[model samples]
Target: MTTWRDVQAAAPEFARRVQSLFDAHKHKTIATLRADGSPRISGIETAFTDGELTFGSMPNARKGSDLHRDPRFALHTATVDPVEGNEAEWPGEAKIAGRAVHSGSIPDGPDGDLFRADITEVVLTHLDDSATLLVIEWWTPTNGLRAVERE
Candidate 1:
C-alpha cells in the first residue's frame, strides 16, 4: 500500500488532478463491506494532511463499525452533473481504493473514530473535448500512472 505522499512523489501531475477532483466538492462517498460481504455506501468527508488521507466517523456509526470489521474501502469524490447538452464541461470523477488503518480517535469533543487510508489504487475518468472519447487514468503503488482512451 502507498500513502498519498508516495503518489504525489511518483506522479505529481496525476496526484494533482486526483486531489483537485476531491477538493472540488465537500462531500465524498465511501464504500465499505458489510458483514455478509455486500457493499454499503456512506457519505463522508476526508482530509489530506500530514501526508496521509484520513476521515472520521461518529462513534458507533454503521460506517465506522463496518470499517472496524473490514478495513477495505473505495472512496469516490462527489459527482457533478454535466452541463446541459455540454458533457465536455464535466469536471470528471475520482476514486481511491484501499484498506483503512485505524489511526486512533479525534482529539476533540465528540470522540470520533479516525482511519488513515492505505491506498492501493486511484482512478480518474473524464471525457475528451468533444465528449466523443472517454479518458480513464489509473495509478497504483507499483504501476504509477497510466491512461486509456476509448470511444
Candidate 2:
C-alpha cells in the first residue's frame, strides 16, 4: 500500500507538471459513459483549486446529463513532446476516475448544485524515468484517496 508520503513526495514535481499542462486555458477531454453504456468524450475547461480538480457545465447539459445518468467518469490530460531530430515523440497522460458531484451556486439559489468527483485513480507517466504510477485504487467515499496498493 502506498501512503500519503508517496503522494507528498511526488507532489512538487507532479504539481509543476500538471500546471504546465494546464497553462492559460488548455482544454482536455472528459470521458464518461452514456446511459446506453457507450463512451462519450467532450472537450471541457479543466481547472484546479487547492489541489482539487473541477470541470464546469451548463445547466442540464450532456456532460451533466451523463453524470446524472451515470456518475462514473474519467478525466484525461495529455501532451506530446516532439524533440528535434528525434523520429519519435514521447507522450504523457494522466487519468483520474471518480463520480461526478454537483456543487456550485446554480442560480436556483441554495438548491443549486456544483459538480465534483472524488478522485479514485491517478495515473502519472514520467517519460524520463520510463515509468508510471497508477495509484489509490481502493479509495472509497468512506476512506478517501489514500493509496491502497502498489505494484
Candidate 3:
C-alpha cells in the first residue's frame, strides 16, 4: 500500500493531473465490495490534504460499513458527457484504486467516520489534443507511471 504523497513524489506531473480532475468536481463515485463480493457503487467526496486522501461517510452508511468489512475500494472522479463538437476540450476523468484504512473518527461526534486511502493505482483517461486518439495514463507504486494511446 502506498500513500498519496508517494504518488506525488514519484510522479508530480501525473499526480497534478489526477488531483486536478478530482478537484474539478465536488462529488465522486466509489466502488466497494459488498458482503457477497459484488461491487457496490456509491456517491462520495474526497479531499487530498495532509499528504493523504481522505473521505467520510454517514454513521449508518452502507458504504462505510463496506469499507470497514473490506478496505479494498475504487474511486473515480465525477464525469460529464463531452460536448459533441468540443470533445477535444474535455478534461478527461481519473480513477484511484486502493484500500481505505481507519484513520480516525469524524470530528462532529460519532455521526460518521473518516478514513485514509492507501493507494495502489491512479489512472487518467482522456482524448488526445487532436481528438483522434484516446490516451490512458496510470501510475502505481510498483510501476511508477505509464501511458498508452488508442485510436
Best by TM-score: 3
Model 2, range 35-132, lDDT digits (tens) per residue?
88999998766666555566677666677788877888877775555465542333345566677766664433333345655665555543443223
**What is the Å distance of residue 108 in model 3 from its true position?**
5.5
Give the per-residue lDDT of model 3 (tens digit) for 25-138: 899999999999999999998999978899988888999999999999999999877799999998899999999998768765456889899999999999999898999999
Least well predicted 10-residue stretch by lDDT in candidate 3: 102-111
lDDT of candidate 3 at residue 138, scale 0 to 100: 96
Instruction: Assess every candidate by TM-score.
Output: 0.94, 0.63, 0.95
Error of 1 at 44 (Å): 0.4
TM-score: which is higher, 1 or 3?
Answer: 3
Residue 15 in candidate 1, Cα distance off native in Å? 0.8
TM-score for predicted model 3 compared with the true structure: 0.95
- Per-residue CA lDDT of candidate 1, range 11-98, in tens? 8988898999998889999999999999999999998897788888899898999999999999999988788899998889999999
lDDT of each: 0.91, 0.57, 0.92
lDDT, candidate 2, residue 52?
55
Instruction: Give the runs in model 2 whose Cα sits over 4 Å from its true position.
Output: 1-12, 84-91, 106-113, 129-151
Candidate 2 vs 3: which has more TM-score: 3
Clashing pairs in 2: 101-115, 101-116, 102-114, 103-113, 103-114, 103-115, 104-114
- Lowest lDDT sum, 10 consecutive residues, model 1, at 102-111
